[model samples]
Target chain A: MLCGAGRDRDVLTQQLQRLGIVPVVVDAMSEPVAQEPCDLVFIDVDVGRHSPALGGGVDIPQDRPVLALIGSDVPSAVEWVIEQGACGYLVKPIRGTGILASLVIACHVFEERTTSTRTISELRHRLKARQLVCSAAIRIIDVFGIGEDEAFHVLKIGSMERRTTVEDLAAMIVSGELSVQALGSDVEARRLRV
Target chain B: MKSVVPIGILFSTQGPYGTVSRAMRDGAMLALEEVNADDRFDFRLEPHVQDPEGVPAAYLSCAQRLLREEGIKHVVGCYTSSSRKEIIPSFEKHDALLWYPSHYEGFETNDNVIYTGAAPNHHVLPLMDYVLRHVGRDIYCVGSNYVWAWENHRIVRELTQVSGGRILGERYLQVHDCDVDRIIDEILDRRPSFVLNMLIGESSYAFYRAFAEARRSHEALHDTVIGSCTLCEPELAEIGASACGGHLSSSVYFSTVETRVNQAFRDAYRRRFGERAVPCADAEASYNTVHLLARALTGTTPSEIEAVKRSLYGVAFAAPQGQVSVDSENNHSFLVPRLGVSRSDGTFDIVRESAEPVRPDPYLVWVDGTGVWASWNGRRRELTNRPRLRVIR
Candidate 1:
C-alpha cells in the first residue's frame, strides 16, 4: 500500500515495477491495509516510537507482513522503525536484490508468525505503527519524486539536520504534523537522482 | 594483430561425469564466440578447442595433440584439481604452457601452469569468517581421497581448529565414487552442525541428496554450515535444484555473482550460448586463459613456448573475475573470492563477497605489507624460495 503522506508515486511505480511489485495508495488503517490481504506490502514508510500518554496515533497489526525501507549506518533509525512495526527493514536507496530480499524476508516473517511479542494489543500497536509509517512514506515519496530509498534518506537526513532524532522526526511525520516539503537537499538526493 | 590460441577442455561425456563437462564447455564456447565477435580483442583472437572427456591420461594426450599436431604452445583445460596434477608433467615435458583453470588444492606448483583460479585466500579463510558467526561449533569435512581433498581438508582443519570448532568427522570417498546410504548414516550419527564437502563428481551429487532427504531442521542445523569451493555451476545442475538450496558454495564466480566483470561475462556467454548459465570456475578460468594466451601469441611469434611464457608471465587483464595478473615468481594469480548460497535456478544468490580480487598466493601464504613475499607460518617450504630471479639485462 502506498503511504499517501510522503510518496513519489512515479518512482514508487518504477522501483516496485523493477521488482515486479506495484503500489496501491491508501491509509494503512483503511480497507486493504486493514484487511491484511495483500500477498505482500512494500512499505517505504516513516514510523514513531511508542508512548503511553496522548496515545501516539497508529497501531501495529501483527497479521500482515511489511517491508520497510530505511537509511544506512543509522542503527537507531532502523531500531525505531523496527520497534514501531516493520517485519523486515532495508536501508535506502534499495539497489540490486535488496528489495527482493526484504520482500522475501517480510513474507517469511509474517507467515512464520515469528514476531517477538505474542500479546494482541502489542500486535495491534505494531500494525498501527506500520500504517502511520506508511502514510509518512507516501508524503516523502510525493514531495521527492524518488524511490522508496530516497524517501527514507529524506527522513533520515531531516532528523540529523533538525538535530532532534530520527525517531522523533519519524514520529512527527507519523503524527501528521510534518510533510515531505520539510526534506533537505542532501536527503532528497541519494544514490539515484530525486 | 590477428591471433589464434589452442586451448583444451577436459570433460567427461559418459556416465555421471558428463554434466560438468557439458556445462563447462557450454560456458567456454559462449565466451569464445562473444570474444571473437567483439572489438575487445579486435576480433583477432581465435580459440582451438579439445575435449578429453574427463580422462587425466586423455588430457595429457590432448595436450600432446595440441602441442604437436595443432602447433599450439599455451593451453587451458583440466578443470579438476586432480586432473591438473596429472597434466603438470606433460607441460613440463613438452615445455608448453597449461593454464590450470579451477580453484585447487593449493600445494602444487609448476612454472608451466598459470592458475587463474582461487588460492586459499580466495576460498578457505573467507568462509572461516562465516563459520565463527553462524555455526555454533563443530565443522565436519567430507571429501574424496585425492590431492585436492587432502590439501583443502588440511586448511579446513586448521581454520576450524583456530575457530574453536572440533573436526568432528573426516570422511573420504575415492574419486568417481558415490556411496550415498553409508555416508548419510555417518552424517546422521555424528550430526555435526555442518559438513564441509570436498567430494567432486557424482559423489557430491549423491551426498547432497542423502543429506536433504534426512529429516533435519535448519535451526537444529543452524550451527552447521557446509562450505565447498570445489562445487561450482557444474555441480549445481548435477546435485538437482531442490537439494543445493541455502547451502553456501564458495567460488571465484557464481552465475548470480554480480560484478561489472561477471555480468558482462554472463551476458556475453548467454547471448552467445542462448542464455545458458555457467557455474564452473574451471570454465570461466578456461575462458580467461584463452584470451591471455591469444594476447601473448599476438604480441610475439606463436611458434615458441618460452616467448609465449614470457608474454603470459608479464600479462595482466581486467578479467571477469577481476584484474588477475600472473605472479611472475610463482606462475599464479591473485584473484578475488566470491561466496554465494545456492538457489532454485541452479545459480547462487551472492550473500557475501570481496569487491576486489585477492592475489592468489599459490600456497595460500599471508604475505607481509612491504610487498615482500614471506611464509604465512614462517616455516618456508622448498617452494617458499622459488629460483630467485635477478635483473640481468
Candidate 2:
C-alpha cells in the first residue's frame, strides 16, 4: 500500500488485517517499492500525486491490480485515478465497513478488465493474421490462376507439408520467404507424395 | 401555526404490484397522519401523492413533477427496484432526496436516495442460512425476469455453491406472467428440496396457488416448500388461504412480530386502512421512512437536501421491526432480519430473528468475504459435504 501515514491508512490496515489480508504499507516518501512482487496495490491518489518516491505521480503498473484511495470526489481527483488505471476506489476517511467490499469488487472488476483486454489484444492479433492469410490466398490465386477456395486449400496443404501453422505459413507466403509459387509447388509435391 | 411540507408520495395503487404498493402507500399515509398530529415537529407533512400504476416510464415523470413542479424535496415511494432505478436520475438531477422504502436486491448506494429497507445481507443471507439448515440444499429457482430476481438468485446460487449444494432447476418468467404450470411440472420432475420463489406480485400469488394445487396431487412435492424474501402479509392474503400457509419468507418486519411497538403499529394500521390493508415489511419500511423523514425535517428546511440527508444519517427509530437505524456509511438501514412462515390467516410466524439489528451490507462485501464464501461461524464447514470423485473407467 503506497499511502501516507494517517487515520485512513491505519483504519484500512486494521480492516485488512481483520479480513486476513496482510497489507504491506509503504510510505509515499520511502524508497520505490517493487510493485511486481505485490498481488494488489492500493495507492493514495492525493499523496501519490505529490510523493517523490512514486516519481512525483502514481505510476500504476499494468500487470498489477490497483485500488485508489481517494479523499475527494472532485472530477480532477476521480479523473486522475481513472487515468492511473485503478480498477476500484475507496473514498477518503476510509471506514472499516467498506474495505472488504472495495477489495472484492476491485479485484473482480480488475480480473474482468484484464481478461477483456487480453481477449481484445488476442482478437486484434488474429484479425491481422486473418488479413495476412487473405493476402497470401489472393497471391496464390493471382500466381496459380486458381479459385479462392482452391487457393486456401493449397495454403492449408502447404502448411501441413511444412509442419507449420496455417497462420505461420500464410505469414511466410505473405513475407515472400516462401513464395506463393513455392507454396503451389509444395502443395503439388505433397499431393504427388500422398 | 404549523409549516406545511409538501412530501411526494409515489406508488402504484392499481397495477400488477398494486396490492403491496397500496399497503406501502397506506403505511406512508399512516405515518403522515401521525407526524401531522404529533406536534413534536413544527412542520406538518402534506403528501402530494402520485400513482405511477406500476409503469416504469411513469415513475420518472411522476418523480420529475414531484421534484420540479411540486418542489418537493423529500419523497417516500417505489416498491420495485426498476421503478426506483428509473426515477433516481431525476432525483439526482433535481438535487432531491428520494426516501425509497422497499427491501431490494442491494449493491447500490446513492447520495440522493436514502434506502430505508432491508439490504440483501439483512434479508437473503439469513434466509439462505435458514433454508440450508432446516430446508433442503437442492433448490429450484423461479423468478420474474428482472434485476431483483436475478440478483437475489445470484446470491442464492453463490451461497448454494459454497455450501456444496445444488440448484436443480431455474426459470425466469415475465413480470405478471401466470403461466406457471410448466414451471410447476419442471419442479415436479426435478423434485428439488425447496423452490426459491423470486417472482413478485401477481406472478408470485399465481405460482403459490398453482403450486399448492400441484402439491396436493404430487406426493413427491409434499416435502418441498416455497421460499421467498419478498413474500409479505398482504401478498399472503393475495395468495389465498389454502396456498398461503407453510411458505417461508425472509423480511425485516412482519405484522405478527409480537412486540409492543409492532402491536400498536398493527392496531393503528388496521384502524386507518381497515382489515383488508395488511402491513407487511415494505409497509413497515414505508412507515419508518416517513417517520425518519419527519425526524430529519424537525428543524431543517425541506428545500435543503444536503441538510436533510445529513440529519438522517445514524438516526434511529423504534420501528416495528425493532430499533432500526440508518447506516451512516451506506444510506441503507440497519435492520433486524427475521425468518417467518406464512400462516393461513395471512400473517407470518416468526421462526428466527437476529438478536440485534444487522448492519446493512449492500454490496455483501462483509457477509461474503474476498473468496466466494467466508466462514460464517463454522456453518460453512458443517454444511459442506462434497462427494468424493471415483475412477469409473
Candidate 3:
C-alpha cells in the first residue's frame, strides 16, 4: 500500500492484517517508486501529487489494482484520483469494516476492466496488421499485374520463404524495403514450366 | 476546600432530532447533579450547556465556544454521528475530551472522545441475529440520510449477506422529511418479513405511524416487524402509542430493565426532570458519560487530558443500563446488549439480554471476523479467534 506514515496507514495495515493480508507499506511522499508486488495498491491520493503514474514516470501494470485512500470528499480530489486510474477508493481514516469489502470489490472490478482493455488492444493490433497486409496485397497487384487472390497468394509465398509473419512482409513491401517485382520474379520462375 | 470543574454540555434540543437530544441532555444533567450531591468526590461539576439545535454547522461553533472560549476540558454531548464528527476536530485541536454518549454506527476511536454507548457489535449485530433467526431472511431497510443510517445499514447488509439472507429493498429519507407514506406503502407491497429502520427523529416517528396506518388495512403486514438498533423510549413517545407497539429495538438500556440500579436511575430522572422526561438508549448513554466523567475527574486534575484519559481506564459505572466501563484500549464502553419490543406506554419490554456485558468491538473486528486487531495500543496483538456461534435470540 502506497501511503504516508501516520494513523491512516497504521489503521489500514491493521485492517489488512485482519483480512489475512499483510501489506507492504510504501513511502508515498518519497522519491518516485514503482508499484510493489501486491494484490492491490492503496495510494494515498492527497500525498501522491508527485507519484510516477501522474507524471508518466513509471507505468503501473494494468493488472495491479489501485485503491485510492482519499480523505476529503472534494470534487477535485475525487476527480484527480479517478484521473489517476484508481479502480476504487477507501475513504480516509481507513475504518476497519469497509477495507476488506473495498479490496474485494475493487480487485474484482479492476481485473474485469484489465481483461477487456487487453482484449481491445489486441484486437486493434490485429486490425492494423490486417490493414497493412491488405495494403501490401494491393501493391503487389499494381507492381505485378495479377488478380486480387493471385496477389495475396504471391505475398503468402514470399512471407513463407522469408520465414517472417505476413504482417512483417507487408510492412517491408509497404516501406519499399522489398520490391514487388523482385518477388514476382520468384513466382514467375516457379510457373515457367506451366 | 472542594475543587470546582466547569463542564460543557453540547446537545441539540431544538432541531430535527431534538426530541431525543432533549432527553439526552436531561439525562446528562441528572447525572451531573447526582455527582455534585454525592460525597464520593471532593469536587463539584458545574455545567455550561449549549444547544446546537441539530444543525451540524452549529456543533462546530458550540463546541469551539465551549472548549476554546469557555475553557472547559471535559464536554459531554452530540447525538448524531455527523454532529459528533463535526465537533471532534475541535476537541482534538483544544486537547480536550468529548464524552460522546450515544449508541452509533461505531467505526471510530479517537483519544479525544470517549464513546459511552453501544457500538455496532453491541446493537446492530445482535439485532440482525434476532431478526434473521425469528424474522424471515428477506429485509427492507429504510433510514434517514446520514452517517448513522448509512453505517448501520452497511453492518446490517454485511450480516444479512453472511447469514444467507437478502435485502429486498433499501431506502433513505432526509432527517426531517415526513413524506414516508410512499415508502411505507412500498414496504407493505414488498412484504419483507422485517424492516430494519435506521431513521432518526421526525422521519422515524413518521415511518412508524405511516407503517401502522398502512398495516391497519393490510393484515399480512402484522407479521412484518420493524427492527431498529436506534429506537428507544423517547422515540417511542414521539411515535405515539398507536404506532409504537410491535417495533423491535436493540439498545444497551430501556426503561423496563428490572434491576434496582435502573429503578434508582428512573426515579432520580423522574424526580429531577419530571415525569414527562422519558429515558431512552442515548439518554442512558449520556447519563453514563456524566457518571463516567465524574468518576474519572475524582482524582485527576480537570485540565490534564492525559490524566483524565488514564483515570477513565478500567473504571466501571453502575449505569442505569448495567455496568458501563470504557475499554482501556479503544475508549468505547463494554455494556450489556438488550433487545426490546416497544410497549404501548412508551416503554420497551426487554426480550433478550446478553448473559454478560459484551466487550465493545467499536471497529467490529470480531463481529465481521476481520481478525485485524486495531493496534490502538501501538503493538499488533494476537487476534482473538472467538468463533461466532449462532445464539438463539
Candidate with maximal lDDT: 2
Candidate 1: where is the Cα deviation over 4 Å?
Answer: A1-194, B1-9, B13-17, B38-47, B216-223, B276-280, B367-393
Ranking by DockQ: 3, 2, 1
Global lDDT of each candidate: 0.62, 0.80, 0.78
C-alpha lDDT of residue A143 in model 3:
73
- Top candidate, metric TM-score: 3
Q: How does model 1 fare in lDDT?
A: 0.62
Which sequence of candidate numbers ranks them by TM-score, best first?
Answer: 3, 2, 1
Candidate 2 lDDT tens digits, B89-160: 678788999999998888778999999988888777887877776677899999886667766777788788
DockQ of every candidate: 0.00, 0.02, 0.04
lDDT by residue for model 3 over B59-87, one digit each (tens)? Answer: 88999999889899999999887677667
lDDT of 2 by residue, A1-194 (tens): 98877667898889998988788977555455454367888988766655232144445677777899875433445666878888888876577888888889888998999899999998888787998999998998898777787788888888887898788889998788886767657557545754
Off by over 4 Å in 3: A1-120, A123-194, B368-393
Q: What's the CA error at residue B140 for candidate 2, in Å? A: 0.6
lDDT of 1 by residue, A25-143 (tens): 65543343455555655554432221212132244455677666552222333454676566786643344456666677778777666544456666676566665656676777776
Model 2 lDDT, residue B378, Cα = 14
TM-score of 2: 0.67
Better lDDT candidate (2, 3): 2
Residue-level lDDT of model 3, residues A3-101, one tens digit each, is: 767667888988888889978876644434464666677787655633242232233445578888875443345666777788889876577878878
